[model samples]
Target: MSLPALSPYHLSLALTLPGLLLLWRNLRFRFYASRRARKIPHAQERVLILGASSGVGRSVAHVYVKRGAKVCIVGRRRDKLDDVARECRAMARGGAQVLMVKADCADPEEMVSLRERLEEEWQGLDTVIITAGVSALRPMMSNAGVEMDPRHPPKSQATAEGLTHAISVSNAAITGNFTGPLVSALSLIPLLTLTSRSPSILLLSSAAAVIPAPTRALYAATKAASLLLYQALAIEHPQIAFTFFLAGTIEGDFRASAVDKALPPNLTSSGSGSDSSEPTPLVREANPAKHGLKVGWVAQRCAQAVDRGEKNVFTPMYMRFGHLFYWIVPAYVEWRARVKYRYT
Candidate 1:
């Protein structure tokens, strides 16, 4: 069937409407950025960070310390926590207070004790950033030590051992990526709401939470769970600002600490260049230190997002489009993911 052609005015309106919307969005972002800059973290502000012993959490602690915020870093390793606390102190030039608490965020008892300590020491909390997460780099079936041929599928009972292994791996991922943040949030929300005029919580989530990828079955599922939990919290408590930092691959030893203990292929290669043709590098790459976003850069951006009370922030900004593209062409996205992770 032939349809009537649009008028020139209709064509002009179609093109102009998108440009106007883009212009409006740009202006709004700038407005909030400027407003947030004026209210950066102050010396008296108290920030409690979980999993601050290493990776993004450690870098974020340094960022807040430089801003003169009274920062408390919590982690399971006392030695690493001490190192982070010392580094934060050095970064602060002795101007900011750094508190180190050795506690597991996933442990409900530990979280409760940590919250009580913060209440007694700081009297309240202004900001809470949960960055503790474990990555899994094996495909769903491989995680269970199973390799199946579609044409000759094994009986369901034959996969019992593989299922057991998968469950164990899944548990670790859930504890680190989901339970930790859930416990910490439940313990600290009251303190945040009661103590600070501008209470903010930043969850260091990943693009995997929203965009499906190869070798991320458990990691993505767990992260998505926590991401939704905080999202629900945001709606339930409108007074406290919640920012979900949906970052892509970040330069660090994060993968080294994956629950699966299976690093991506070519883990040691030193390729630093990202493909300029792609909108964003949302795939696993070799030597994240060379190819991924700098840890410090991400931390600074995260702090800025918190200061701005941003709801969801995607690092490199272009990664935000990935969600739209995935929704439109999921198979294409999955194929690219398989290629990046070297699954095919």
Candidate 2:
């Protein structure tokens, strides 16, 4: 069967609907944003932020404190936490308190203690934002990087091995990025003193959950698993508002930290020097500048989502389309990935 060629009018007609839809969406978003801006009034709030020492966590802490929220910042680094606490204190408005708690998210005991400490210090929490996660970029899953080559010997192997082991153990256990936040949220939710009618448990996820990019199999798997857990939790626990911030690459120190914790392959064997200690091999990292979003913008968007009691959110909102597109035509996405990321 032969099809008739489209005339100029037909082509124009085809574009009309899409153009109208775009205009409508823009207007709707503007109205929605304005209403949310007015709705989320500044007042004292009890907020617990995990991994708030730096990056998106720190940005969110600053936003909350600026609006007169009592913020508790948690991270493994005491010094970084203290620095974030100091910044939060300075940024705080009227009577906003900033507290720093040093703890590891992967540690059940530490997490339990964190819950107990929060219970003692504050009556309840209004919001719990968990943004602690680890991701390493490697060309392949098995090899950490070329750092294990004989040309390079590490000054510290025990520490690297220990950290890598912990990351590995957590990845396998439910307590890693997969369920650590969930467990932490569950422990803290019980102590939630709801300031507003809707209390929120916000998880900071990644777009990798749905994108399925290369070189991030473990990272993407963990994040996707976490989303599923939270989505199910949302249905099970209807009393609390459980939301996810599915973020893209953001301008933060997360990448740097992940790289630092990344251990060289055969770290145990490579730790010992052979007469001459070779210089540490540097892992080639992608410049996140290509895809990074500003931490402040992401924080603000997340804050609005929490206030609006949204269920799922994507930073740089347009990324939401990619999720829908992937679901609608998964084969297209797979083909695109294979072409762009060179995934076999």
RMSD of 2: 6.7
Q: Candidate 1: give the clashing pairs.
A: none
Model 2 C-alpha lDDT per residue in residues 4-113, reported as the tens digit of each score: 98999999989798999978866765665455446434564678899888888889999999988778899988988888988887788987888789998877788889
- CA lDDT of 161 in candidate 2? 48
Worst 10 residues of 1 by lDDT: 268-277
Best by the TM-score measure:
1
What tens-digit string does per-residue lDDT give for candidate 1 at 275-311? Answer: 2222112234566778889998898888878876678
Enumerate clash totals for all models, in the order shown: 0, 0
TM per prediction: 0.84, 0.74
